[model samples]
Structures are given as C-alpha cells and as structure tokens.
Target: MSRPQHFGWFLARGFGPQGWGYPSLDWDYDWTRPEIYQEAARTLEQAGFDLVIIEDAPSLGSADTIDLRVRHAFGGPKHDPLLLAPYLFQATRHLGVVPTVNPAAYLPYTAARQFSTLQHLSGHRLGLNVVTDTGSARHFSDSAQLGHDAAYDRAEEWLTGIRSLWRSWEEGTLVRDPDTGVFADGSKLQPVRHRGAHFAFDGPLNAIPFTDGEPAIVSPGGSGRGLGFAGAHSDVQLALAPLDEASVRAYRAKIQDAAIAAGRSPADIKILFAIQPVITSSAEEADRIVAASAHPDDAALVQIARKQSSDLETDLTSLDLDRPLDITIFGDHVSRGSIQRLIGDRGEDVPLRAHLTALARTGRITDRSGFVGTAEELADLIEELGDWGNDGVLLWGDFHPVTLHRTLDELVPVLRRRGILRREYDEGGLQANLRAF
Candidate 1:
C-alpha cells in the first residue's frame, strides 16, 4: 500500500485577507474577527489535514514606500499569528496550528516559554515555524543587517539556546503531592547556561516539561545554509522548489544527505513542497480559471512590481518599464535566486518594465505554482509527486471561502477515496502525527 501523504495549508496572510482581488461573495470579509480562521481550521480538521502553517514577516517589504504595500496589501497590516494560535487550537481538535516565529525578533526565553505553555494547553498540538528574518534589519532597530549565511548562523545559535531552555525542566520535575509539604522535586530541575556566538542565556525555563516533548520545529529556506539548518534542527522543512520531479528529488536528496551528515536519520526530516492548486469541476472551467488567474491587468502589474521592489530593496518605479534592466544595479540588495527566477531564460538585457509586465500578465511572479485541473487530476499530480519521495504538500489556494470549501469538501474526499490522503488522524500530538507517516 502507498504511504499516506501528509497535507497542510499555507496561510500566507495569517488571519488576514485571502483572494486579494478575487470575488468572495460567500466570505464574511471581516478579518478582525477570529471566526474566519476558526472556520478554516475546522474545515481542514474535517479534511484530516496534518497542519496549518501561518506564514509571517516582521517587517513590510523593502519597498521604497509603504504606500503600495499597504494599498495593495502585499505585505502590510498583519496581526500576529501567535495570537491566533490559541483561538485556532480551541476551534479544532486534531489539526496542528504552526505559527511562524522569527528567531531574530524574539528572545530565546520568551519563545520557549510561550510555545511551551501553548503546547501544554493544546495537548501538544502546537508547532513553531522558525524563520530567519530577511526583511530590512533597520525595521528591527539594527544598524546593519547580517549577511545571508551569518543570519542562519545566528538562527542556529538561537535554536540551540531555545532547545536548551526547553530541556531545563526534565520530566517528573513537578511532584505535587497534597499530603506532603514538598510540592516539587528540586533535584530534577536543571538550569540552562548557554553561551553562544549569537545569543547567551543563563537559567532554567519558566515552563515545565511538555507532555509530548518540544513543539515541532519547522524550518523554511532553500539556500545552502538553509537546507543544512533544516536537516540538522527542523523536524519539518517547507520548500518552494521547482515543480519538476527530478529537481524536487534532487533537492530532497540534498536535504537527506545533510541530515545524514548531521547525525540524523533521513526519515526524521520531512520535506513538504509548497504548492497552490487551482481546482475546478471540469477541465474547461479549470482552463478558464487558470487563464484568467495567469494574466493580471495594469493594477496587478503595479502591485507586483511594487511588492518585488520592496522585497528586493530596489525601486522598480524609477526604472523605465519599457527599457531593459541592468541586473548589476541590484548588487547585493536582492537574492540571486530570486533574480535568476525572475529573469528566467531571458538575458539580463531584457527590459525591467517588460519583465514586471510579463510577471503581472502571467501571474507567475508569486511563490504559488501548481496544476490547474479537476480535483481528480490535481490528486493524481499530488500522488505522482509523493511517489517521487516527497513527504507531503503545503497547499495555498485563492483564499476564497468557496475555493477553500471546495478543496476540503470536494478535493480532499476524492483523495481519501483513492487512499492517497489520511482517513483519520493518528492518536497523538503534532509531532507524533508528523512522524506517523
């Protein structure tokens, strides 16, 4: 029998607007209330999804101005996902609620205590998606930003300290006997004295040992240092790799090798591909949606350019859209991988305006990519990828209630019938459920 595939949803806008421009007459459209998230979590739970990850960033994009970012809602005005976690957990029983936490933004002690407390309250269903903040460091009151590799180094130290703090109080540390005067076992508790290059902490964590161990550690980055970090530290690694089977397999192999080098079992680390599936009832309808979704008009083009410029820290507005772009101008400001993907097969001499326009028109600039087809066709694609050594998929949709409802009510049932998806969650916490497959 085929191994059961894990399924997760990538909440790009944590408790915020989804399906930015798309019509959502069915949605309540009130983002401030937790009802939308609660409803979404319930839907995923009913569908037997493994987890729901809330993606977050500390700063708005590196754009020259916040106007575009706010106006377009590309990366502006997001409430903390951590705040939403408790509400989500209360609303669902089995589905894991993983919130993104930037190591750079939070102190080790604070993160340890917060996550540990949640883990205890949620029956160990909480998860932490550790992110190395890459947005403008100035936003965090830093005079200068660390280089790419150095940031990961800092994250490594941060995670090490966090883990140390979590282990401060061992199991059985608490001995609450009403008859006896002593309420706890002092000998069992240990203080964490960790001094690292990036961070230092001295003392035991405030929280007690978690019932199911530490909250699941999730790492998301595709760079060399990122893969290494994920292999060594994370239980799950979210990847946004190319959709081709060979490329995906190769990336998985790289991560597996890193895990082996790090003295970890390959199976201990699960790599989930990030995908956005466009599902429709019929092939013709699917084609129409895909075609419409691919092409964005003038407003979308501006929004895309503005978002990219903010992220790359380069102002695309100043550059003439009709003229070719000088890649040299970006210098170290932008990620090389991002630039390469944007340029694609086109030479550097290609006009910046044309590039952004093409991205806007094609709707390919965003991180979301996957098949546009009927539910069964989409399931086939997911299964084929899983058969090629992928652990699971982290799905992103248009965020319309109808779209999400269809994915859960329509697509998931089909997968379950084919034995591609789980019929019910394994009895345990988030970590156990993750390791079940």
Candidate 2:
C-alpha cells in the first residue's frame, strides 16, 4: 500500500487575469472581482487539496519590456496576491492560501503585522511565499538593491526580523481573564528590536498572537542560498526537479542535508514538487495530443513563441525560424533557467525553429518523464513518488474554476480511491494539515 501524499495547486497566473490567453476566459467570469477565485477556492477544498499558491511578479521591467510583460498578460498587470488571500480564506475553511510576497516590496515591520493579523483571522491557514526578487526594488524607495546571493542574504535577515516580530509576545503572555476583564498581560510583552545588515525594525506588534502556530513560510528558489533559506526558515519548500524515483530521492537528500546543517530534522520542511501534468480523458486522447505535437506547424510554433516571449522579456515571434537564435536578445534580468527550459535539450547552435519544435513535441506519460496522460497514468506517477517517500505535488495552473475542474474532475476521484489524496482536512489549519501526513 502506498502512503498518502500531500497536494497543492499553484496559481501560476497570479491574481491578475485568469485564462487570458486560453479560450476559457470566455467562461465570462470577472477576474477583477472576488467571485471567480472564491468559487475556485471552494472547488479546491472539496477536491481535498491542501493549499493554493498564488504566483506574482510585481514588476513589468524597464520601458523596453513593458509590452513584453503585459501585451500577452504573461507576467505583469497583476494585483497584490496578499490581498486576495483573505477572500480565499473566506471561501474555504481549510485550504492554505500562500500568496507571493517580496521582501523588497514590503517593509519587515509592516509585513509582520499584516501577516500576523491574517494568520489569526484565518485560524492559521495563511502562508507567505517569500520571494527575494530584486528587480522591483525601485518601487519601494527604502528597499535594498541587492545581487543574486545577496538577495537571499537580505531575505534571511528579513525572515529573521519577521519571526522576531511574530514572537514579540511571550508564550503564556496572552491571558484572558473574563472575571478581571484582562485580555493580555502587558508585562509579558518582550522587547523586540532587530538591527540587521538589511533591515532594522522595532516590534511588539499590535496584532494578537496566534493560539496555533504562526503563518507558514514557503520558498521557491532552487539555488544553494535558496535551499539554505528554506532549510532554516520555511515550512514548505516549493521544490522543482525531475519526477523520476532516483531524481526525487536525490532531491530529498539535498533538502535533508540542508536541514541538518540548519539544526533541523529532514522532516522539518515538506518538499512539494512543482508539477504541471496535461490530463486527458483517455489513452487515445492522450496519444492524439502527443501525436499533434510531433510536427507543429508555423501557427502552433508561433503560439508557443508568444508565451515564451512574455516570459523571456524578449520577443521570439519575429525571429527567423531557420536561423540560430541570438543569445544577445535576452536581457540581463531574464532568467537563464526559463530560457534554457524553453530550448530544452536542443543546443544553442540549433535554429530557433528547431528549439521551438522540440518544445512543441510532447511525450507519453507512460515514459514516466513527460506529462501527457490519463488520470490513471498520472496517479501511477504520483503513487510511485509516495513509494519513494516523496512528500507530494503542487499542481501548476490558473486559479480559475474551469481550469481547476477540468484538471481535477477525473484526477481527484482516482487519487482518493487509491488512498493517496487526503480524505479530510486535519484540524488546526494549514500548518497542521502539512504535518498531518
């Protein structure tokens, strides 16, 4: 028997427009209002998902890149996901709402107070996907402008300050005596002052302390510094790697090593691999999708190019199909990982068309490496992960009801019947839900 695995949804499109490029936007739900997301949140809870992670990129880059970011709605024009969390909390009782939050965007003092209030408000289901993005530092006048690893340095300091603020009130400090009408012991409030290399703050936050644990911390970085930060502080590591049994076990060991170095047990952090599987109704449909990808025409290649253009911060639509791509076209800030991911195994010497064509080629799920598959096939991969002692998966998609149901409608029942998906949410909210397994 396979042990159950935790599951979450990654709202890759953020709190902005949902299904902008897809035909499902015609579903006619207003993305601006809260109703669409609320409906999605309720659907996720019913499906036994533990959480939904909202992805956000707070900047549109320089004047040259604004069109690339917003023209296709790939990166920018997103509202604050932190603000959207409350509406999600209102819609569901158990699903954890982890909104992307940048240390560069929010002051430590302010973030702590706001996060603390939300944690208590939601009964501790609130979580912060702490990001160390330095591109948007200009938006906040006081924000530090740091380099790659330095950003992690500041985030470490920032997280330290936030936790200091969270623990301002001593344990047993809040004593509610109805007879005396005393809600808290003023004497138990500890002095909270943080003076660090990146941040300085004084706190004894006005927000009440949580009776359960504090809001969970999540990190999505894959670098050495990123892994260290996750090991030291995060309750959830939004991990990414190949999903093979060997790769999964190796990745788990790396995280365990990092945790051990941080004086924490390997189990202190849950490793939820980020997966985006293409689910199909049957083996025939899955094969059809893969077959269509083998030789994508100009129109299909252009569609893939359009999506890549938005992410790379450079347009690929105009590039000559038969000629090699000029590496110079990408800006300094574009993630090399994203560009490499686009090109995949195809070398840089190859023509732009070859790279795009390789991307368009889809493989069968029976390969255990590619994503296209039926619900039963997807479950097989998931069960294999559990058998390897892997934690779970975080499914990536738009936070819209249509996209969600289309993916989960067939998948959830199969997982539940296999005894993999959670049957009921554990008590004490998100943190408890995570540790429950």
Highest lDDT: give the candidate number. Answer: 2
> Model 1: per-residue lDDT, tens digit, 1-437?
55578888888766556656566744556777777788888888888889999987667665455665667666666778999899999998899999998777877888788888899888899988987766646666555677778888888988888888888777788877889977778888787888787667786887777767678889887888888999899888898777777889899999999999899999998888887766667877765665785556666666678777655656666777668888887745356656765676678787875677555442221222446677777777777777897899889753456668866667887888778788778767898898888
The TM-scores of all predictions, comma-separated, are: 0.90, 0.95
Cα TM-score of candidate 1: 0.90
Q: What is the C-alpha local distance difference test score of each model?
A: 0.77, 0.86
> Candidate 1: deviation at residue 322, Å?
3.3
Lowest lDDT 10-residue stretch of candidate 2:
331-340
Model 2 C-alpha lDDT per residue in residues 162-239, reported as the tens digit of each score: 888888888888888899999999898978988888788887977778877988899987777788888888889998
Runs with alpha carbons beyond 4 Å of true place in candidate 1: 177-181, 289-300, 328-337, 345-347, 357-370, 398-400
